[model samples]
Structure formats: C-alpha cells, structure tokens
Target: MEMTFPDAAPPFLADAGWAGAAIEPIPGDASARRYFRLRRENGTAMLMHAPPPGEDPEPFLRAARWLDANGLRAPQILAEDTGAGLVLLQDFGEVRMREYLDAWPQDEREVYAHAVDALIQLHQLPPGPFTQYSLAEYQREARLFIDWFCPVQGLYVDLKSWTEAWEEVLGPLLARQRPGVTVLRDYHAENIMLDGGLDRQGLLDFQDALVGHPAYDLVSLLQDARRDVDPVTERAMLEHYITQSGAGPHFAEDYARLGAQRNAKIIGIFVRLWQRDGKPRYLDYIPRVWALLERDLAHPALAPVARWFDAHVPAALRDPTGRLGGTFAV
Candidate 1:
C-alpha cells in the first residue's frame, strides 16, 4: 500500500521542532491507521497518519485524554491535525505485550495480571464519552460471518434465522447489563504495550472505545484470536478480574456470552479482510478463531445459538480447510 504523507511536514510536527527528525514507518495493525517513529538527537516521537473518509483522530484523542486523566497510560498528545488525520504522540517503545510474552513465557501470569489491573482501572472510570454497545450493534457485527465468511466457501446462508437465534442467545445477556463500564473495544495483547516508564500496561488503538459491559474487554484479552493465552492463565485471569471487580455470580456467563459473540464476529472479520480488504493472510487464523468459537458455543447459555449453528453451518464451514482449500486465496 502507498504511504501518503502531507504535502509538507504536518505543521504540528514542524511546530514541535521535529523539522529534521528521521522518519521510520512503524508496522500497522488491521486498521487504516499508520504510525511512524520520528527520532531526533534529543527525543523520539510517533507520528500517526490515519487518512480520512473513515479514519478520524478526534474520537481517539477524546478517549486518550479520558484515560490519561484517569491514571492510565494512553499516549500523551504532542500535536494533532484533525483535518489531515495526523497526530504526534509520545513514543511507547518497541515491545508489545505479545512479543514480550513470546520471549518470556514464564512471565505470562505477571503480565496478564497487569493487563487485568489495567482493565480494572479502566472499568472504574465514570461512564465517559462513548456509545452504548447495543443489541443492534452486536447483531450487526455477528452478521459479518454470514456476509463475508459464507461467500468464500461458496455458500449463502440467509442470516434471518441466525439473527433470530442470536436474539434468543443474547436477549437475556443484553438485558442483564447496560452501558456501565468503559470497554476498550479492542483490548488484545497486540494493542497493549509494555512500557514500564508510564503505566505497566500502555494502551493503544482505543479509538473505538465504548460504554459497555466489562466482560467484553475481558473476552477480547483472554480469548485473543492472534495468540493463545493458555487455559491456566485464562482461568486465573478470569478469577482475578471477578475478585478484583466484585462482579456477581453471573459474571462467568456474561464472559462466555460476550466471548461467543466476539469470536463469531471475528470469524467474518478475518474473512472480510481477505475478500473485501484484499488482505489474505488473515485467512490463516480462521481455524483458531473457530476453535475458540466452538468452545464458547459449549456454554449452556449459548445452546440456542449452538443449535442454530449445528443446523445451518455444517462442520465443513467451521474448519477453514474442510471445504475451502487450506491454500484458499482470492
């Protein structure tokens, strides 16, 4: 993909005395946003270029400010150009928690505990500026599986029955909670940095934060699609969060519900990244995501949705290579 920089340096960068800072492209995630590490003799900074139509920095700025105020380590904004979707920010260093855990598997427990602590801190914030994660939103995201995943397998399953089944599964769960905790919509290891200078967990890519049930972020973290957080760590983290947060007895069910819902949505997202976004590598993760989804489906609360899946989506559809070739690429 072509990297588009402003005609000149962003005025904000120039104003911040970064006129001759060396520009280095930082790897981006699944989003359109790009980051560059700008280094100079005195200091280092990050330039975020999230070009417009869909990539606005306003919401990110607001959320970062709220988090920083509440004693979390969201990057401090040095400068911004909302018109150009540019932001100059504090550099959070190189090691993502994912990479850290890969290098030192023994530290998984300690690292994940801090991640849990970060969530505990985050959820404690007074309901801030964020949209509610409504049932409509959940259903819409779940439909991505039907929209994108089906086409790859040469099938078109009408999602009316699926949505109806979801209503049966999610209706009670949604009613059990409203917009209470600030859910960092994407809280996986990839978005979390391990910068000891700031906070133990350095938060990133929270531009899509929402006011929702706490279990959603927990699901995102423990049931990560990109990396396997082992069963022991996963169980310990859940118990720790419940103990720390004082969530009631039904917390486990809520976690399972959101975990199922999230994994279901991600199945389509990975497929869509290939079919629509022209990024085929994500297809490799389909099986891992399916495995996680199947586990969540085993929850008793998911019986209705599980029956729907068993009836409609066959076993072949669950495994990426069962019907579609493992080398399936568009």
Candidate 2:
C-alpha cells in the first residue's frame, strides 16, 4: 500500500521554505512515522511526518538538540511544526554504518571501534533532559514478553512469578546505574550514519533516549536485531569500551543483565509488530534474538529470568517457528 502524506504536510513544508523540493519517500520501520528526502536545487533535507496520537516529534526534537549541543552528530533541525507533526532536517546522506560494513566487512572493526569511542565520549557528559530508565520502565519493557509473546503461543504462564523474577534480577542492575548516563535505546548499526566518515557518526532514531546504564546501548549495538555481528567483533568492542571508558569490574555482569532484558523486550516487540501491527517481516529476527537472549540468560545474573523461561517458555517454543504455525516469511 502506498503511504500518502498527511493533510498537514504541504503547508508545513511550504512554511518551512521547502514548497517546491522533490520529495522521495524513505522506507519506514515499525513506527508510524514516515520520512521523505526533500531535494531542492541548492541542497537537501529530511522531512519527518510523525502524526499525532500514535507518534510525537517533541522527544526527537529534544534529543536531537541535546546530542547536537553535546558535539554528537544528530541531524540539524531546519524547521518544525510540532502541531502538524512535521519537521525539516539536514540530510545526512545515504551511507549508514550497516551498509558501509556490508560492502567492506574488513571495516567492521574500525567502524565498531569508532562507535564505542563515541559512546565513551557520550557517557562522560551528564545525561540529557529525559526520564531515567527506572526499574519500573525496565519491568514495563520486559513484560512485553508476557503481554504479547506468551499469549500468542497459548502458554498461560505465571505472571506473578514473571514480575518477581524481573524485579529480583533488575533491582541490583538499576542500583548500580544510579545517576546514569544517556542511553540511546535504539543505538545500533542501522541507526548510525557515516556522515563525514567514521570519526563523526550521525545518530538517528534516538527519540527514545533515556538516562540509563551505559552498557544498554552497547548491547543494542553488538546484539543488533537486523544484522549479525560476529562474536569476536562483539567481544572485542565490548572489552574496548570497558577498557577505554574505565568502567567498573562488574561491567560485564551489567552487560549480561541489560542484554537479557533488552533481548526479551525486543522479542515481545517483534512479536507485537507481527501479530498486532500486521507487519510480519519483523518475525524473521526472532530466532536470532532468542539466541542472544539464551546466551544472556546463561549468565548468573539472570538466573531468576532463566528459571522463569525454563518453566514457561521451553527451548522448542523459544523460536517463532515453534508456535508461529510454520516457517516464517523470509
């Protein structure tokens, strides 16, 4: 189905002085927000349409300003009409980190190192004006597994125990992250733009930024849902971040804990995307995410969550194929 511009788009663009630009639609992710590349004779910009009720542009604007002010490379907002849910932004061009590494896999180490360095620099600063990723928030996200994935599989597990397990496991994790660093929740290869080379990575999709653990974003990067990061590269970049950032000795445990919580959230999210939102393509990533989650669960920190999974979600039902009725769409 073709996606049409919202009723407020034309005037919004015109008022932003982009009335006559050639508009090219960019592919969308799971969100309702739509993006367009606006090419005028002089230059180009990105047009974001985040229609209200389901999406909002204020958080994006806030995070973008904070990141740009902090010397990170977020897109410069050219103009915005928050009421109309439209924003004009400086174009970062097409070379993203994922595609760059795809063409030159040898560049993986270099690019990942640069990303880790960026995170190190980001963590040094105080967190932006955003809510902290509190224990409740982590629990809320983790419960997506119970809310979406479990019911779809017809497994009526103990919700009370699920809650207790997450609380027990995550309480200490949150305790260690007090007065936390800025965590760009969706930080990953796809959201990073190679605008001006690897030294200056352009950040995208950071509207959901929060004050949280530093290790969370690293997990998002190394255990990315859309692509497979080699285990060696994952470990190397992790150690690189720890050594360079002067993180605590327990950083590895924190990484495992966050990785498990994050993977569980993503599993529920992907399942919700397919079953509730009618986009089945996300289902393709479930098995990979399960693998990552399983590895994280093996860590002693996640023993409670691991036990819950052992009783409720068996290894057979862990993959989408087991309960999704057959082979998933490619």
Candidate 3:
C-alpha cells in the first residue's frame, strides 16, 4: 500500500529533534492507527500516528507508561503530542515472535515457555490503570458474533438468546476476577516482539489492556487467530502456566470460557472488517477462529453458549469464507 505521513507527523518529529529523518511506513493492523520507522544518522525510533477522531494516543501512552513502570518491556516514549496523536517510541526492531517461530519451528516449546513465563510475571503484578473487564463488557463483545457474523452468513440468529446465553455462563466466572491482574487483550504472538531476547519480550498493541481474568491473555496467545499454534505446544504452555502461576484447578475452565468469548468476538470483528471497512483479507482467518471456538464450546463452562449455537446456526453456515454471501442489514 502506498503510504504517506499524517500532516502533523513531520512537524511533530522535527520538534522532537528528528528533522529530515527518513520515514518508512509500517503496515498497520486492524486498527486505524498508522506507524512509521524514523531513521536518523545515529539511531532509529518508531513513530506512531494515531490520527484524531478515529484514533487516540492517550490510552496507549497510559498503558505504555504503566507497563514500563512495572518492569515490562512496553516501548519507551521518547516524545509525544497527544493532541496531535503522534508519538515517537523506542524501536524494538523486527523480530516478532510469530515470524520467528515460523522460521524456527523447533524452538516452539522454548519460545512459548518464555511467553507463558511473561504472563505469569504480569499476572503477579497489580493491575494496570485501566477499567476492569466487566461482565457487561464481555456480553457486549459476545453480541458482535450475532450482529455481524450471522447477518453476513444470511442467517438471522437470535441476538437476545445469544446475549442471555453468554451472560448466564459469564456471570459466575466474572466474580473470580476481583482485584484482577492486567490483561493484555491482544497478547498473541504477532503483537509480541522478540527483539532483545526471550526473557524480555516486547509488548505491542497493549493500549486495550484491561484488569481482568489472567486466562484471557492465555487464550489470546495459545489460540491465535492469524496463525496456527501447534496443539502440543499449546497444551504444554497451558500446563506450564498453571504450574508456574499456581492457579487453581478451575483455571482451565476459565480459559475455555474466555477462549469462546474471544474467538466469537474475533469472528464478528473479521466480518465487520470485511463488510464495514472493506478489508476482506481478514475473512481468511475466520475458519481458524471457528475451529478454536468449536473447541471452546465443548468445555462444560460454555454449555449455554454451545446450545445457543447449535439451535441457531447450522454447521454449514458456521465457517464463513470468501466474500460472504448476503448484504449485512445494519
């Protein structure tokens, strides 16, 4: 994609003593935020352009500061102009965990071990400065599946029943998150940077951090949407986390609940990305996410949700593929 800096980006970089730095635009994720790598004679830094109205940099700044303060590896902010939505951050370099793992599949166990350890490390710390991931939030997110996914499949699923089913299962589990730990909502391999080393994993896209159940991030890691995580590696890491974190026996159940919730949300999001935003490429990941959701629904904790799915959506309509069939009536 042809990329250009936002209007305020140049002056903002110049004020930060990066005048005339070569700018190379970085491909963005599913968010409105854009990024560029700034290269000067001496060093390199990352410029995050979270444009106003659609995107804001304040939450990212707050999360970055909190993570760094608590000894995590969120990028250090060299300069910022929140009003203009521009931030220059420490460059963590190109070694993302997902890409690295693809190249060295043999290192999966060890690399995943390091990631599990990082989660244990974070869960032990006090929650970051973010709102609790409340039951309402969970329900609202779960509704996305019916709202977006069902319409695209040309199936008018029961939105009310979907909400009730999620709430029924999610309510009791919600109590366990009291005095919760920081949850990086998107803590998958793609958002993890392995620049320095495995021990010091660099966190990216953590602006959506929440104070919630520890299992949420684990689901994000082990059941990634973008790529397939080996089943053996996933099981080993989950066991490793339970052992190292000293979590209760019920932790596995909670992991399944959150997995169902997250995967369902992702399916809705991928559809929205295609139908609303005209980004159809995200549709390719729905099959993978559907498989994860199917496993999640099998767990007893998600029985209510499973029944809802069984009653409303047919197996043939479950996995949406290739430029969905019908118009999503908003």
Candidate 4:
C-alpha cells in the first residue's frame, strides 16, 4: 500500500494537520534530529524530529532568520511545535553541495568560491546570541578524548598533566583570536545545501552556532573531516578568502591553531559516537581526521598536545584500527 501520514504520523504531526502528507526519511547527519521530506496536496516541507530535553528547534529558527537577514540562505520556517519537539521547514531540496561538487568536479572552484563568499559575508556580521567558543569550551571538548577514548583503548590519562599540556597548546589561540563572529559551528561541505537560488548555497546544521573567532568555519570548510579536498584547491580558496575578507596578518596562524583544535575534538567525538551512541561508522574517518590533526600539530604552538598524544595514546590508535590506515585519500 502507498503510505500516507494518518496512521504513520506521530501524534504531533497528526495534530499539526499533516495527517495526509506523504513522507520519506531523509539521510541525517551525526545529530539526534531526524528529518522527513514531506509532501501534501497543499505544500511540501521538511519535518524535523528534534526530540526535546535533548534537541530544540528555537535555536535553529533563530539562526535561520538571522542568516536570512544577513544576505545568506537558510530555510524558511513553515510551522513549529516546540513543545512536541517538531517543526516544519521549507524543503530546500535533496542536493547537498558536496554531492553536486563530487558529481561535477569541474565546477568545484566556482562552487567553493561561492561558499567562501558566504563565510566572508558571515564574518562581517555582528556576533549572535550563543555559547562563546571560549578557551574553556575548547578545553572541555578536547578532554572528551581522555574521558571516552582512552578507556576504550586500554589506557589511563593523567588528567592533571593533560590539562596543563592543553593549556600550553591553547595559549597561542587564546592570545590571537579575532573579534567574535557568528561561527556556523559545522560549516562544512555536507552542511552546505546547493539550493538553486541566487546565492546557490544554503546552510544546514547550524543550530549549534557560536560566537567565536572568524577562522573557525574556514577551518571546517577547507579541512573537511568527511572528504578529502585537494590541496591546490584548498590553498586557492584560502587565499581568495583572505584577499576578499581583508583578514588580518595572523589569519594563517589562527587557522592552523583552530584546525588542530577542531581535529582533536573530532577524535573524541568520533569515539563517543561509538562508545555511547553505538555508532561505529565514525571510526572509519579517524584516519583522515588523524592525518589532518598531524598537519595541524605541525604548527610549533601545538607541540604540547602533540607530545601528550605521543606519550599516552600510542601511534597505532591514532588512525582507525586495523587496515584503515592504508586507504587514506591521496
């Protein structure tokens, strides 16, 4: 039987007058939020399943409007039932920019240029209301490696020593932060939607936006965890952004600092996904993430954390376990 929403719709969706909508689950990212691409005789929408007490749509709505006002593309809110942890959003289509670029690699430069321009525009906007991605937050995220990952690897972390090492590692980043901006905390290729609009770009997964250094999202784009961006292309995008944005002299240094910080956090997060969330798929990306982390640690300022990793975690565990080390993107 061709399914419709009446029987399948949850209590909330049925109450929201979507009882007859045709719905299909869309692939989701590494978030608790679930999505269903929905179509009814009246209109089409994307239904977000953000089970509250853990997920909320208010932040997403706020960030979306803010992005829309700032000359970028975020989805329009169709309807929201925050109390039931559900919201209906304008469907921005299924074509993620990553899929588009990969299918048509010839257009990568132009597409990435547009993405960079979006970041440049975002950097100029005044800070938004959110968690400040402060040194304390960075430290807290990095400690996830010690808390969740170490035990799984059959190792003990010396918290006191590790804390001091991170403090030293984070010193240069703290001292050289740019004025805060609304950092779309996960502004990577996958989160970018190829909405066929004037901007040709739409942002997703930005509910976790933060007030932090401008270079943070830049790192997220150029040093992607899920895909391998070619080095020449990556360099061109960086130079283009610097020229267009009139970024200060410390841009490269700050970028490397934040890149390493982000990659370190990924190590912990990937492990947590496996340990607590029962998702082992993230472990597959550890090799790529580790390679990126090594490059980040090449910055002289990050040596403390580098030394700490070497001392405790051992070299073998840095990459994915067993044969994953060999399949790295060249």
Candidate 5:
C-alpha cells in the first residue's frame, strides 16, 4: 500500500543522523493520522504523522508520560518535531490483540486476564489533574446519534422527548457512582499488543484517557471489537476482575450497569462513525454490542430503565437504534 501522510515528510529525517532510514507504513486506528516504522542507524523508532495544527501530539505525549510513570507500558517519546507534527516513539510493533486472538483462540482467557490486570493497575492510581468525563460530555456525544445516524436512516427523533429521558436516567446513575483514576477510553482488542518476549502487553491509542468510572475500560476490553466473546467467558472474566480488585459482591451489579451504559454509548458511536465518517465496516460489530446491551438489560439491576425501553421503544426500533443489520431507507 502507498504511504499516506497529511503533508510532506519532515526534512529532518534526511539529515545526518536519520539519513537512509527505512520508513514503512504501519496500521493505524480510525483517525486521520498515519504511522511509519523508521529503521535507521540510530535505532528503530515509530514516527507519528499527524497533520500540523489540526491534530496536536501534545496530549498524546503528556498521556504517554503519565501512563509510563505509573508502571504502564506506553510508548516512550524519543524525538519530536511539533512544527511538522511528527513524533518518534518506541516501536511497540503492529501486532494488535485482535490478530493475536484470531491466531490463538485458546489463549483468550489467559490473554484477557492480563489485560484485566493492566486495568487494575491503572485504576489503582490516585486521582490526578487529568481530564474528567461528565454526564454533559456523554450527552454531547450521544447527540451524534441524532445528527448523523438518524438522518442517514431518514428517521427524525423528537429530541425533547428522549433526550431528557436519557439524561434523566443516566445523569444520576453516573453522578452518584464513585470516581476512579484515569480511564483509557478506547482500551479494546485493536489497541493492545502482545509482543513476543514482553512480559506485559503494550498499550496504544490512549490519548483520550479520562478520569471516569473504574469499570469503563474493563468493559471496553472484554466487550471488544473484531470478535465475540462467549457469555460464559465474559462472566468468568467479570468475576475475576471483581475478585482480584477486592471490590466486593456489589461490584458485579455495578459492572453490569456500567457495561450497559458503555455499550449503549458505543452503539451510538459506531452508527455515527458510519453515517458521518463513511466508515461502514464498524456496522458489522453492531450485533455483538446489541446482544451485550440486551443481556445487560436482563439483569435485575437495569430493570427500571429496561422496562422503560421495552414499553416506550418498539421492538423493531430496538435493533435499528442498536444499529443492527437492517435496511431502513437511509
């Protein structure tokens, strides 16, 4: 594949130290950014090609420093050219957890347990000045569903009717919950790497880390993209997390509720990605997420909201709202 950069390659790479480096394109996430593996006489380093002025690397750098300082495996920054939006970082390689899972399905439990341990390690950190994710921010993100997906489906929603209900149900639910340390907002299969000899996994794409619910990142991992985890395995992992963290029996209930909320928000996000960003591949994962939401709703913890959904929201609308594979005009 041809290399894609937002702008021309930086002039520094042609200088004395980095001359004759081999620059190879590396896989990236769902962002307008690119990465290259730069192998030079100095050593192997990863170059991040984010467009100047639009996508600043400062946040990523700061988050990386914070995570690295706290016993996590974030890429170490080696060199940076802020003016050109290029950053040289430790090469964590391109083996995503999704690929590893595909190659070794039998190791899913053990591998996922490691990820759970990582989450526990992260949540153990004391509160810091990192970003905070509030109900208002979540509501703002939820609007993407109305603005993007609803239009694509040719369905108009009375924002006044459901918006308040959503906020009302979720507002206190999130507000009353105990706050945690930083959360790696996108800690899923694609963002983790199982390096061959490394004792711990490598973390990537954590620039959006926030101080939010303790279970949020764990839910993001076990309930992931690129694969469907068996319900039996999901329960075991949930129990393992609860036990290992000493969060007590109520932890399971809290985990289920948070998982439901997180899954609902993600469904909306995937739909918005398809409708607005033209990334329709994410639509394939809708069924898995919907199944999770439905299963979570079955739990007694969510009975009130689930009953509301069953009564006010039609069964046909459930799958559509969940972005399952159904052709609805737009």
Candidate 6:
C-alpha cells in the first residue's frame, strides 16, 4: 500500500470545494519522499507524499518558510497535513541545473554564478539554533566511504588507520573554519532549477540546510558529480564569490581547503550511493571529482590530507574508482 496525498488530503480541501486533482509522479532523490504535480481549476501546485507515521513534513515546511522569508526561492508551503505527511507547495518548474547545463554547456558559468550568488545570500543570513555543523558529524559522514564502498568493491580498508590520519590532518584544518551560516548540505546541480518564467533560479531539497562553512556549498556546486564544471569557470566563480563577499587574499586558501574537504566527502558519498542505494549512475563521475580533489590537494593548505591519501590509498585505485560501467581495471 503506497501512501499518497489523497489518503491524507486536508478536510478543508473538501470544505473549500477543491476537487481531487490529477497527480503526476516526479523523479526523486535518494530520500523516500515522493512528489506529484497536481492540477486544479485554480492552477498547478506540488504535492509532497512523505507517507504516514514514518516521515514528518513539519521540518521541511518550517525550513521552507524560513528560507522564503530570507529572500531565497524555496517553495512556499500552501497547506500541510503533518499527521498524514502531506504538503502542498508552490511549483518551481522542472529545469534541473543538470538538464540546463547539458542543454547549454557554454552558458553554465553564468547560470552557476547565479547559484553562487544565491548561496552567498543564504550564507550571509544570521545563524539560528536549528543550524549547526560539528566535526563529529562530518567524521561520521566521511566514514560512509569505508562502511559502504569497501564492501561493495570487495576491498578491505584499514579504516582505523585512515580515521586516525584523517583526524590528525583534516580534522584540525576543518576545525579552524568560522561557522554559523546556512549551509545547504546538498547544494549541487540537481537541487537547483533554472525557471525561465521566474527570470531566476529556485532552490530545492534544502531541508538539510545547517550552519556551517560558507565554502562548503561552493565546493558542492563546482565539484558536482552529475556535471563537469571546467576549472577555468570554477576559478572565475571562486573569484566572483571572493569579490562579492569582500573576503581577503586568504580566502583562496580557505576555498581550496573547503574544496578538498567537500570532494573527499563526495568520493565517499558516491561510492556509498551505489553500494547501499543501488544508484550506480553516480560512479561515472568519480574520476572528475577525484581529479578536482587531487588538484585541491596540491594546494599548500591541503598538504597534510594529500600526503595521507597518497600514502594510504594506492595510486592505481584512482582510475579504478572512477571508471564507471565496467569493473575495476587494476
């Protein structure tokens, strides 16, 4: 029995004389949440079916309200039935950044600049109690690489050694960051939409936004797995962010470090997505993400983590980890 909005449609919909509308399923992310496009006499709206008793729509609705209040383009919650996990949200269209970039690669930088600007605006907002990022949380996420990827690839990793080195090197580096800003945990291509009608973009799946490093979202955008953003464009975007934020020359180093950290986390995440979630589509992008990580590691700021990866992980593993649609060559 699949749970759906009709099962939980608000009583007010009937009281207000709203007829049941057609629902079309939309592609979803890794979450169990599902979306449907609904059409009524009035217009179109998005219906979220999160299922009953298992998931709650309150957090998402709260975050959406907070984001909308802050000049961000998160969908406004029209109505919600928290007990049944159903919500009606404003439709933001379906032009995912991935699709937009594929259709016009040349225009990617400009469009992505808009995304970065949105991120900067989000980061500039004052932090709230609901948002915070801790090193312990990051370390736990990083471990997904070892837990999920190692078994899927039929390889044994000395995670104990890796964790010790990771803490010794990357830990302190991340610890130095000034936190307390809205960090959209998955601020990547798929979660952004290029809505032609709005003359602007919209943000999606931002329920995980937290107070963390401002550079984290930047890395998430540029070092995306589903799309390949050129280094030249990435550099220009970085410079644009620096200029806009009025950050000093040291900002470059911070950006590089954050990039390295974000890429490492993604490498682990992609592998886990395939091994645990049956989403092997993400594997093909590993090489590009690894290449970006390698480049960032070359920066002086990331030397410690670079040396740790070089010494612990075999060089031959690079191509094998990245080559999708085939088994590891080495």
Cα TM-score of candidate 2: 0.96
Go through the candidates in order and give the C-alpha RMSD of each one to the true structure: 1.8, 1.8, 2.4, 3.9, 3.1, 3.1
What is candidate 1's local distance difference test score? 0.85
Q: Can you give the TM-score per candidate against the true fold?
A: 0.95, 0.96, 0.95, 0.90, 0.87, 0.87
* Alpha-carbon shift of residue 46 in model 6 (angstroms): 0.8
Instruction: Give the number of the best model, judged by lDDT.
Output: 2
Query: How many clashes in each structure?
Result: 0, 0, 0, 0, 0, 0
What are the lDDT figures for the candidates, one per model?
Answer: 0.85, 0.89, 0.89, 0.80, 0.72, 0.73
lDDT of 5 by residue, 201-311 (tens): 999898777787777787788777557876677788888888887765556666667677777677777777677677777777766777787877787876755765575
In model 4, what are the clashing residue pairs, if there are any? none
Runs in model 2 lying further than 4 Å from the true structure: 319-330
Instruction: Give the worst 10-residue stretch by lDDT in candidate 3.
Output: 321-330
Q: Residue 301 of model 1: what lDDT?
A: 87
User: After TM-score superposition, what is the CA distance of residue 245 in candidate 4 from its true location, in Å?
Assistant: 1.2
**Off by more than 4 A, model 5:** 6-8, 14-16, 41-43, 172-179, 197-199, 311-313, 317-330
Candidate that beats the other on TM-score, 3 or 6, i.e. the better one? 3
Question: Residue 182 in model 5: shift from native, Å?
Answer: 0.7
Ranking by lDDT: 2, 3, 1, 4, 6, 5
Residues 45-77 of candidate 1: C-alpha lDDT, one tens digit per residue: 999988897789999999999999888899999
Q: Which residue ranges in model 4 land beyond 4 Å of their true spot?
A: 1-19, 41-43, 197-199, 319-330
Tens digits of lDDT, candidate 4, 90-192:
8888788778878988878788888899999888888877777788888887888788768876788799988888888667666555458898889888988
Question: Higher lDDT: candidate 2 or 3?
Answer: 2
